[model samples]
Target: MAETLSAPALPSVYRQLLDAIDIGIHVINHEGKSIIYNRKMSEIEDMEKEDVLHKNIMDIFLFNKEEESRLLQALNHGEVHHNAKQVYFNFKGQEITTINDTFPLIYEGKRIGAVEIAKDITRLERLTRENARDKQDARFTFDQIIGDSNAIREVVENARRATRTTSSVLISGETGTGKELFAQSIHNGSERASKPFISQNCAALPDSLIEGILFGSVKGAFTGAADHPGLFEQADGGTLMLDEINSLSAPLQAKLLRALQEKSIRRIGDTKNRSVDVRIIATINEDPAVSLEKNRLREDLYYRLSVVSILVPPLRQRKEDIPVLANHFVNKYNKRFQLNVPGIAKGVQQLFQEYDWPGNVRELEHMVEGAMNLIYYDERIDYTHLPVHVRNKFPSYNDISHAPEALVVPNAPPTKPLQEYMEEVEKVYIEQILKRHSGNVTQAADELGLSRQSLQYRLRKYRLNIRHS
Candidate 1:
């Protein structure tokens, strides 16, 4: 009697398991024909598998010759190919991008068909494109911050070095000096770049709310208490920038000091403490030492937070950077509003170099932006474009009673050449313009209907004292 042969049984969940997969999956026979295809694979190809069963895989799909040849070789060699790039042409005549991994199915040491798994990476590709666009839009770098003065350079150098460390940083600067920008740049350059960076203004919140906000409150902890994580908790594994930190109350300052020292926080109305890992970066308009002496800030907390301190110089001290900053703002607004208002005139540059900018760089930026909006095409900004207060503060060219008047030839035959007299007039006018625009060459050029390069040359020729106006 011949021995009876029994057919091998397939696993009960084998088909169900393939169908449940989220990724597209299919099987191809030795002849390169699709033997089985899951619903996802059929949908990805935009075709019904029933109509394409036993069809040549390459014939139904649109793949590069190189990729097709590689897949065929893999099948022939019974080798697995992971993460193969392939393009699939659907019934709708659309090219679908996909990544596939092919593996040969071996049974009893005999080469069978191959299983192919594919995943659509279109969303991931779109996300990458959007990220590139966002980075381009946010292009404020350390170099973009204008200021060649030694004071400003020192501040920038310290900031750059401090960015490399994980210690707490305290940025001290007057309002409008771009303290927040420095903080953001530090966070961007730090190891926690990918992590969340949160900022909170201590002056903006009340004492009661400050406590609940810094150290999150549990449900029913207060009148409107809803359980919520605080900024410290939310910024775990990242940086938390506290603006106007000196504004925090003395008692609340103690709580903050404790949290910093302990690296943990206790929720309001809860005794349990939750560990938190976050870097604290704080900014104060006033000196931390002075704030501590006044009892407005805790000395212990000030020392702890000021491990790395940076003091941004006021704009008046960095007068040389005025022209650079003004030009930057003009270009910014010109592109923003699509205005054709050309460069600042020589007169405006002279005024900018002379004006005492109390608000520093922030004031200069705003003044430039405001002037761009106020001026029109071919119209150079004159003394009138500047704010009345600024113009009134400077001494006019006609009001030089203390100095001896210019010697006139009276009836003497036109002694000095006309060009020399004209040059003298131009020098005086340019000086007035520089005084009017507060040392901003771009603004001065725009006001005088002259190019920045031309005004710069004239300024150097006249040997004018172009520092703070």
Candidate 2:
């Protein structure tokens, strides 16, 4: 007689097959007790076989309503649920979000049990929401931050040291001082550069929304809420830049301090804690001492977040950097406007240095951009090209002319590439039309007898920046 495999050996083969599947397999008897919970199901629920096997589903999991538990519904009602999403908490207090297909099991024409095939989407749900949000691209690095002043160089050096470790950083500076720029640079230089570099402006959103955004939320946690991961979870293994952190309310500050200390966060209305690994870089637009004294920022939270503090000097303090920043913006707009302007005029440079820039580096950039909108190709930005407000600051600006002298070469021909020559001619012609129409693109396009969009495309193609006269 041939040897035969025993009946006990058959269940082992079936169990191995069930465990091999990626989807969670859960089987429950008519009494709603879990009869078979495969390895995948155990992993999905973060529960062990010993804990779930032979236990009632209700005893292991909490459902908002009996109807919400798909497995139980299948066993009790002989119903089949397909591609249904269920968000519920397990006994261990962990929130489990899954998409499930459940069906009642029938044997000999009698409803006996229920079987559920589940796809765990806890992480995917969070990632989907995170990707949907508008995120700024972290493109700046230490090399891109243009400033030669000692004040700025010292701040940059401290920020560079921050990248070497996973310490919390607090960057304090006035508004428009490029605090976010330094934050992005440090993130790019850190080991977590490859990971998500998430930024949230604490001042932009109200406290109610900010809490959910930073710590995440579960379905039914609030009206019109769904399962989602917070910034901490989304920025796991990376950096989280909180801009204007002092704007956060005091109660939120206490909560933030807890998350930093524990390295874990509890979702809104969640009972369980989720671990996260995130490097935080927070910024404030006032002195830390003033913010604390005014009760705007919590001292305890400040201490926690300021493992490394960096104070960026304002534009007025770092006046030496004004010329370099202006030049950088000029080069940037030169490509955008398709102009070949070499540099700014000396008169304009003198006024820029003399003025107390309340808006800091951002004001300088805007001034450069405004001037670029008014100039022609091959012309340096001059005093007359400066915006009216800048000119008004220096009443005698016209008297101080700094025009670029023509380099007269004996017997040298004015030879250039045909493409360059054509571009220059087209740019000047469009500019003249725009000037005639007071920079109205529609009127300019109609006067030029081209479609509005067509003329607009040409404007961009030739890098024209038209300002209304």
Candidate 3:
């Protein structure tokens, strides 16, 4: 007979499983008493299990109120909270930040208790603050942008006009469309150019921490807190480039709107408001209208931030600029790599213009850099020197003429596993569909027989950074 598993051993197995998890786990009973606290939880909170076990939550944690404790909320109100950011002090007077998913435990249709899974991000918050404090100067100027197409020129003019005033500017475009470049150019041309230019990606942190990072905090605001200046204070009389502004939470948007209107901001838990003279330049990866419809952005804040709006056109719509950008990249890499490569082959140049360039100018630049790295004896970059992804984008890739010595074998069998192979094909197919629809996600989703959200998930999953129509 095989070895039998006993029922009593089940509890031990469950305990082991919980301890093995990477995230913190804390469970409480109906009386708000700690029942199970995993090893990860102890590690995250920097406390021992014995310190928490058999203790009331109120006795162990420093929550402001019973309702403020997510575990208590689940036990009392049967409410579920997902990806909620919580900032609170532990019994040891240390402040902690966590993204929590708390759910009520129900038995026989009656509330019993609650369990919470928490991810610690305190170090991330500290690092973000440190990075913001060490931000560098704006290097790119208006003259550095390569494109001369009417599409680019119009936006350049619009951005230039934005520099004349301190009005908030909203720049919208696809990823790698040079939104930050335009932002830097605008700041360098403005009166504040001599002052600081600090940039932050709003999506980099959760709302709870971003608030502190943006507005700062006093020493007594939270446990382990200190006197710190925020981005607004650091960027006083200068420019603050907030990239991916749509990623900010609703409460943050409201706070930001107030700050913009009042021309002042208050530190977290501080009563006094400090005035700032920072010019705001924000960027969004997609159209603002779509963001509003999706409830990802606030309309009032959009109007406030878009006082001077600029939309940078995608690469496909401005194909005429590809040759100039390509040549610029070639020249750039030549100087850096210390190589004397002549230029891109005529056929490769034609290919670059024909390709959809879902990743835009950034993609073109990377492709050139990749090809330059591969060249040794070649006098010029050619079709054969291109990255595999670029070549695979064309169905007639094999038909293109490459240097005779460039090939030993053709149509080699794929070395990757089947799952990887299928994913590659699927990614390329989705990209082609998006390109065909001119990056209209809804239309592409329809053609692909998928819901818009599902297609969007796949786009992110595959990292297919494409422009929206």
Candidate 4:
């Protein structure tokens, strides 16, 4: 025999692949006995492979109790489940709430077994509780905002002034503009600094769950809801930040107003009212006027919540602060990544100033962090280390230095005034861009290297109605 080769066994290959996966994988035969349980599954369930081998998956994960048998249901009825939530207890009494996607395993036109891919939410639940504890003792204060621009200082002044009183403060800004930082700083600087300071995103939870999270829940509120104290109670005598408050439904708005007026809340499925001495700090991504115009937020609630309003200016409006922020991020990441990075490259600083950060300061931080990851022994961060997305925001260095300015209109109407002719060229330029982008102001603005607000103002001046949607 000149040469001999053998392919890996199918079972061995599958076992290796399943073991490599990060999420738990479980399989059960038609009789509900475990057939393919991987190492990740064992680790997620806090069990051993030997314990789960040949045992029924329901028996192992659900502790010998058949409460809502997903595996059996799939195998017997050829059913499928996608992102279905389930809670079960292991033999060691560890409760795991998982989102599972179960599908029937078919062979030759017959259901052979069922397979399930699950992500254990046990750690997520723990982190959420720990987050509540962390909020009780926040770290970031007003001094940590790291910007000296008048735009930033104006908002900080308003926030600091509002901190003295327990009046409801509304801090409005886009994503990653450090709205939560302002909220926490206000709390820390307030008289209620010693008490708990809880913050929750109103948009994170569904309407049904949102109510219970804010006002709390009784034993029989819905289904599995235990006697839990809501965020309002947790932040009693302190601050409760309801971020993205515009996302709350109309009914919830009424309830929130009632709670604010009475300084009390009634838990779901409970009649007794609980009084809470909590300061409210609300954050909205959009302008309050726009929100009120669209009826996305209630009028009464807005008046109550915006007793002291603070609008954090977007990063683009205050590009002068980019140098300070960039240096701050470099120092922060140098210690984090254990590098001796000196500072940002001058070329990178220019690009950062030129680019419009749609995601605001968070995007800048992420870009810096990404650049740091790519850099190893370099003393200074440079343009080459910039992420592809950030690099793609503008033209290449060669293009910017050499690319010819595009012609607006080839036919020069010599009969008109120079200013009028220039206006015509501008109109034609805007028209073409709007048409190319299907009348999207944001995209057109980005392509033209102008801010969205500036583009909108020009559209009004030119009487162009570019449909944003």
| lDDT score, candidate 2, position 340 | 48
Off by over 4 Å in 1: 1-140, 395-469
Report the lDDT tens digits of candidate 1 across residue range 156-191.
888888778889999998888889888877887778
Residue pairs that clash (backbone atoms under 3 angstroms), model 2: none
Error of 2 at 50 (Å): 81
lDDT of 2 by residue, 50-138 (tens): 88889767657744245878887887788898999987777554668899999999999888999999999999987875765546557
> What is the Cα-based lDDT of residue 177 in candidate 3?
93
TM-scores for the candidates: 0.57, 0.58, 0.57, 0.57
For residues 1-469, could you state the per-residue lDDT of candidate 4 as single tens digits? 6543336566677788999989999888877888888887888778888877797554455222243678877888878999998766664446677889999999999998999899888788779879867655665788899888999988888888987899999889999999999999999898988898887999998998889889999998788989999989988998898999999999999999999999999999898999999999999999999999999999999999999999989999988999999989986786567554667766677888889889899998998899889986334677678877766665563233322255467466668788887787888888888888999776786666554445666798999877853
Query: What is the total number of backbone clashes in candidate 2?
Result: 0
Q: Per-residue lDDT tens digits of candidate 3, residues 133-230?
A: 57677878899988889989998988899889999999999998999999999999999999999999999999989999999999999988888999
Q: After superposition, how far is residue 312 of candidate 1 from its true place, in Å?
A: 0.5
Model 2 TM-score, all chains together: 0.58
